[model samples]
Target: MEWKGRRQSDNIEDQRGAGPSMGGSNPFGRGSGGGFRIPMGGARRAGGGMSIGTIIFLVVIYFVLKMMGIDLLQVMGEGGQTSQPGFEQTETASRRSSAQEEETKAFMATVLAETEDTWSGIFKAAGETYEEPKMVLFSGSVKSACGFASAASGPFYCPGDHKLYLDMSFFDELANKFDAAGDFAQAYVVAHEVGHHVQNLTGILPRFNQQRQRMSEVEANQMSVRVELQADCYAGIWGKYTEQKGLLESGDLEEALNAATQIGDDTLQKRMQGYVVPESFNHGTSEQRRRWFKRGFDSGRLDACNTFQGDI
Candidate 1:
């Protein structure tokens, strides 16, 4: 993939060294300590305690901040300082990142920009507006609206916050452990997560989440396979757009296909535990993944990527 000097996304939140405890304020207009609180009660109680209305107001504020991706209680526990420490640590970590890691970050940003452009165009053509999702880069562990996650959890999209969380170190694992080397493979990973964001925007993810509440464990796993495979197909749609733009070079398509194959549920299960359990397979088999991706790549149609219509 030739991504150098291309447009990069400004929606990336580099929280690389901020760790799980450092939940920063909202990146989009929710200012830090803006002092716009409702004074429900101006006077304190007889014993120097807060009034009932004051306590209720504080509780409301807490929940509001939580919804905005800011853990106000956590911030108060950390001395009411959210951005300074995390910002300084992230800056130091960025300076410490090797040249290669910085390049990887740039590549991720470029790919994210590509997805934004591609999806925005598709949405606009359909008479809809695409709200681009943010990507959060972290090291070790991070706290998201979905809860706390470690780097070992791999890349994931959180519908609760409409953001994608990624650990750049996973690319090294993808190459060294999974043998899925190459930048296109890395782009596939990023695109796959963005695909989940697409699902969230389209109401597919919300519907699935609601329906899964009444499903059995086995049934939920089966449904999850469809969700994941649809994401793979969506990634292929992005790949098709990229190819049409002449961004893909020789062997790039193969790299993405190999990546889809390598990370398939069957392949990963066999490689990790020497066996495969079909019922527990939530990401489909290697053949299924490769086929769906090819379907999207060949057709380049949204309708071609629907995995929930039949036997997917």
Candidate 2:
């Protein structure tokens, strides 16, 4: 939380005002509310026609969400879905966009630096060299090796690109909607995504993906839970660096724990629909998520993050 004066990362690609492209059912269809909806609150520029304002109304949102070469409407013409990239002077991109975006970006950069330092030290300790990854920042939607993604996908790390993707509006959701507001809470999000990058670098993600492809839908969903849980633990390990920097505020841990619970597959499902169907779950239950994150926070050891163990 004490991230001021920390170094900012130059790896960011600010595509906040990019063009739009409409598309389908979340493509991979995770927890996104629906079309044109930015996951949480950062799905590109949800502009025009004024449907839901929460980053969920903007047409052509597919350009940001799932992104994967999905662009349809060329020019819906304003009322029907204008083709132009909606660059309206909205409050989000404006000055009122909260001082937190800059702070969060800086914090994320600091966290990245710490991860680089820690992981490098870790690899060196293990007689290997660490490969650092970059973080990409965009608003509305942006394209990547993983394809186009609206803020609807939330923050994710694409192993294909070896970079972490984030939309700062998610930080706003962390504060206002989820009530999991805290610098560390936001930091946890970055760390968790970066954790995915770590998993990719360690060959865990690919192995999981390969195995998941061979498994039944139910089994694959379970595998995703393990993967997500391990990422939580990794986030906790990254969080250890925060403590070393004297960044632990009293409510900080609670905020992060709250976040772990907030984005649970169960919680999100219940919020989006009405009930929780375990079969359709991929991210894991709230308690499961909280436990894994706590496990990582308590141990700060990479080995302890093995959610893929036989028992997981």
Candidate 3:
């Protein structure tokens, strides 16, 4: 929250004005029921035109998957194919509503740098080199390994590409729109996504995929809630480390808590619709989110964030 004049990550890909397109997108995030399908667009070279070897490899793998009683299409679909990150057609657009957007971008860059520093050191201490993931900054729409997403998907870390995508306008959406306006609140957003990256590192992503495969609709949603809550806790872990390193002000932690509550599934649903549906929740409830974040903030240890094996 008190970040300024700090290091900025060189890994930021500023694709703010670039338009995005997708090949196959699951609107409900692949198996959320009602079957969401992404409309096809012109091939982005990444998803189109498989090489001969790639085709043969797919053919062989398909039979192997068939022998294992798995749908090759579903397997390939769930295990998203690797796509090269590229900016789509760049329009001749310039910055508008300059003040808030520009400043938030700078602040986001600084925050991302701090996360990189924190996570990189943590990984290095474990004797593994930390590969810094790229953060794509977009304005309205952006293409990611996950698919094409608008500002509405919030911030997400795409496991397929090991990069994080964000639409900076969400800061205002969080502040004026969601009533979670604070600098620390914004940092928490970035930290939560980075927490997803940590899950990727800890093999939690693969485990989640397996669980999702075996879960019922309601149970899978609950699993997703646990995953998201764990991310909130992981964000708190980052907060604790930063605080110990003399980086937090007195009210900073509260700012993050306010954020955790602001974007809670029930709160967001009520704001968007007229009521809350507990069964449809994927990111956890307000209490669960705030508690997990506070847990991480208090403990500062990754072991304390075993939201997968523990109660929310």
Q: What is the lDDT of residue 109 in candidate 3?
A: 85
Q: How accurate is candidate 2 locally (lDDT)?
A: 0.78
TM-score against truth, every candidate = 0.76, 0.73, 0.73
Clashes of each: 0, 18, 0
Please report, in order, the local distance difference test score of every candidate based on alpha carbons.
0.92, 0.78, 0.84
> Model 1: how far is 126 from its true place, Å?
0.3
- For candidate 1, what is the TM-score? 0.76
User: Mind giving the per-residue lDDT tens digits that candidate 2 earns over 167-216?
Assistant: 88888877787677777777888888878988998899999988987899
Relative to the unseen true structure, what is the C-alpha lDDT of residue 215 in candidate 1, on a scale of 0 to 100?
Answer: 100
Model 3 lDDT-worst window of ten? 83-92
RMSD of 2: 17.8
Alpha-carbon RMSD of each model: 16.6, 17.8, 21.2
Ranking by lDDT: 1, 3, 2
Instruction: Give per-residue CA lDDT, model 1, range 1-312, as digits (tens).
Output: 989999999999999877445355575565556643456765667857687888899999889989999997687767645557987999888787777788999999999999999999999999999999999999998999999999999999999999999999999999999999999999999999999999999999999999999999999999999999999999999999999999999999899999999999999999999999999999899999988888888888899998998898
Question: Residue 90 deviation, candidate 2, in Å?
Answer: 9.5
